[model samples]
Target: MEKVRVLVVDDSALVRKLLSAMLDSDPGIEVVGVAADPLIARDKIKQLNPDVLTLDVEMPRMDGLTFLENLMRLRPMPVVMVSSLTERGAEVTLRALEIGAVDFFTKPSSDLANCFAESAQEICAKVKMAARTRPRPYTQVQKIDVPPRLSADAVLPRSQSPGTRGSTRIIAVGASTGGTEAIRVLLEAMPPDAPPIVITQHIPAAFSGPFATRMNNCSAMRVCEARDGQPIQPGHAYIAPGGEHLLVMWDGAKHVCRLHDGPQVNRHKPSVDVLFRSTAASIGAAAIGVLLTGMGDDGARGLLEMRENGAPTLVQDEASSVVWGMPGAAWKLGAADEKLPLEDIAARLLVLAQQPIAGARRAAS
Candidate 1:
């Protein structure tokens, strides 16, 4: 099998060396070259013609974002960002993803050597994933008309009341890789009174807060980072905070968000498996599970559990996904009740949310 070629660009000599060593250690990957700045990186790209690029957000000659914009415009290829675990880094990394970068890794603040040592597997895996990603071209901006908010009671099924103890329905969504944009497209299209949504998108600490804020600005439903013990309610979406696992649990008569600092599941802190498994256990037939565009099978088994519990489950179709690995795995496992395009997912979800939970499950089965 042909190895995936990689180019590492960073102003820090240590970071570049550490990254190269980590990536090269993997038999499936080869570090083609290293660049100290974007200017040098640009030249190396033309020369090496690498399959993937690992870019630093802050570099000497030119910033990563600016170079990324130019690269996407001129010669689009898969790129993964190397970012610091800071608020500013998080904000900038999100922008890079919007600009067509495939994925990202957050640098640890302390113990650089130990951090790289711990993240070696992750670094290699992302590079391989990046090589398989379909790079979409950056085109002219299009305007999206923000729809007006509707009452929660109006959008949901008459069989259940909104946030009435055990009477509410829940939606559990999981995504990674190209998930940020995939999620924005889905959420922005949803009606204001859609069922409460709980999401676990692979991201680093500090990034999930900003991500939720950004999603809230564009989405009809209120989006916020999940907090421990927060009540799940209609017309709202809770994003699992990064660096922790987010779970849904019954608190007396109400469903509430539970944050866990437990060991990473399937190599992810905020694993989709954790969220889907929790929902399957707590919400059962009262829930809808969605597995969106991502790079691995983290949520496949959890989604299967949801299906086995009589919950309707959906997976984004391969044609619309940036990386169809996650959804494909779920579909192969027979976990997906329906496979639909990205543009059609929200509308279908709205229809499902309006049906009696039991009826929906029966129909899906």
Candidate 2:
């Protein structure tokens, strides 16, 4: 098998060296060269013609985002951003993603060496996944090796009975990899009065609030990072805050949002499985489960549970997905009721939400 060639670009010599070492540790990856800044990276990219590029957000000669914009416009290829875990870093990194970068990871605020070493596995995995993706021109947009993972059972137990019925319907969404943009596109098309939407997108704690704010700016529905005990209501979308799992629970009168700061499920905090399973247990047939583009099978089992409980479930088709791992896994497991393109998902969701809950239950029966 051919090794995935990589170029490490960071202003810090230490960061570049650390990143290069991380990529080199993976047998499937080869670090072709290292650049201290985007100017050097530009030349190395031309010379090395690497399959993937690891870029830093801040650079001396040219900023990472500016270079990224140029690269996407001129010669689009997969690029993974290494950014800081700060409010400014989150804002800039989000812009890079919108400008067509494949994915991003935040560098630790302190103890750089130990933190980078600990996250080496995930860093290399993201590079490997980036190489396989077909990056688009100024259009937006993983961890590779599957280590032992804990399932939703780690946080929430599987419900033995069908979900309790509710008067109104809810939508459960899960995505990763290229999810930020996918979620944006889906939300942008929704009407102001759309059904309540609860989302789980793999993200770091600092980025979640900004991501929700960004989504709110684009979407007709009000989008905010979910709060514990918050009522689930129409015309609003709740985003699972980073580092915490978002779940739905019956509040006697209606379904309400619940946040769990528990162990990582499926190697992810705010895991898709936790949210989907919670929706399955709390709303049952009164909910719709939509699995979008992501790198792992985190949401597959939970989506299957939702389907088993008679909720309409759909996945973004491969052609429209940046990475099909999550949706593909769900489809292979017979979890989804339909596989639709990204352009059609919002319309289909609206239709499904309008369907009677009893009709969904009877169909499942």
Candidate 3:
């Protein structure tokens, strides 16, 4: 088996060394070279032709984002960002992903050595995943025709039935790996009056806020990071805050978002499984569960539980997934009620959300 070649680019000599050691420890990966700045990294890329690149957000000669933009435009390849756990770092890291970077890792603020020690396995796994990913180029700006934005009331016209504004019907979505772009694409096409949406995207705490803001800017529905006790409402989407667990719970007669800090479930805080299982327990048949592009089976069992409880489950098809691990696992486990391409998921979800509670129950039965 051929090993995945990697190039590590960081202004910090310690970080570059630590990253190289961590990656080289894995038998499947080979540290091809290390660069102190983007200018050096650019030359090393042409010279080494590595399969993956671990890039620092703040380099000396040139910033990571600018180099990433140029790289994607000129020679697109898998690039994973190594960023600090700060607000500014989060914002810039998200921009790198939008510019076509494959994934990211957040460096710990304290105890750098201990942090790298703990994260060795994850770093190796992500690099392996990145090697398999083929990042799409963002060279030219393309104009898309967006429909006139509709309010929640307009999106979900009140039916004469019992499933009205306070309806427990909701949408639960989960993703990782190529998920940011996948989620953006899914949400951008949705009507403003769509059902309440709760999402779990594998991200760090600092990045989630900026990610939600970016999503909101492009999407018709109001998008924000999930807050503890925030009321779940139609025409609004809630994203699970990084480093916390986001669960939907029944608060009196209405459902509300609940955020809590807990031990990592399936190696993820704000895990997809945690959110999906909560939706299954709380809303059951009234909920629609979607598992999008990701690298692992984190949400598969929970999606199965949702299906068992009578919720409709959709998985993005392999053809459209950046990595088909999550959705593919769900399909293999018989957790998915339908397997659809990325483009079809939003429309299908809208149709399902429009069904009255009783009608949805009947269909499930």
TM-scores, all candidates, are: 0.88, 0.95, 0.89
Please write out the lDDT profile of model 2 over residues 1-365, one tens digit for every residue: 89999998888888877777767877889889999988888999999999999999988989999999999999999999998999999999999999999899989867887777778777777888899999999600023345568999988898887654676889999999999999999999999999999999999999999999999999999999999999999999999999999999988777899999989999999899999999998888889999999998999999999999889999999998989999999999999999999989999999988877865445344
- Candidate 3 ranges with C-alpha deviation above 4 Å: 139-168, 358-365
Clashes of each: 0, 0, 1
Order of models, best TM-score first: 2, 3, 1
Which residue pairs collide in model 2, if any? none
In the order shown, what is each candidate's alpha-carbon RMSD? 10.0, 4.0, 10.0
* Order of quality (lDDT): 2, 1, 3
Which is better, 2 or 3, measured by lDDT?
Answer: 2
Query: In model 1, which residue pairs have backbone atoms overlapping below 3 Å?
Result: none
The local lDDT score (0 to 100) that residue 228 gets in candidate 1 is 99
Model 1 bad stretches (over 4 Å): 139-165, 359-365
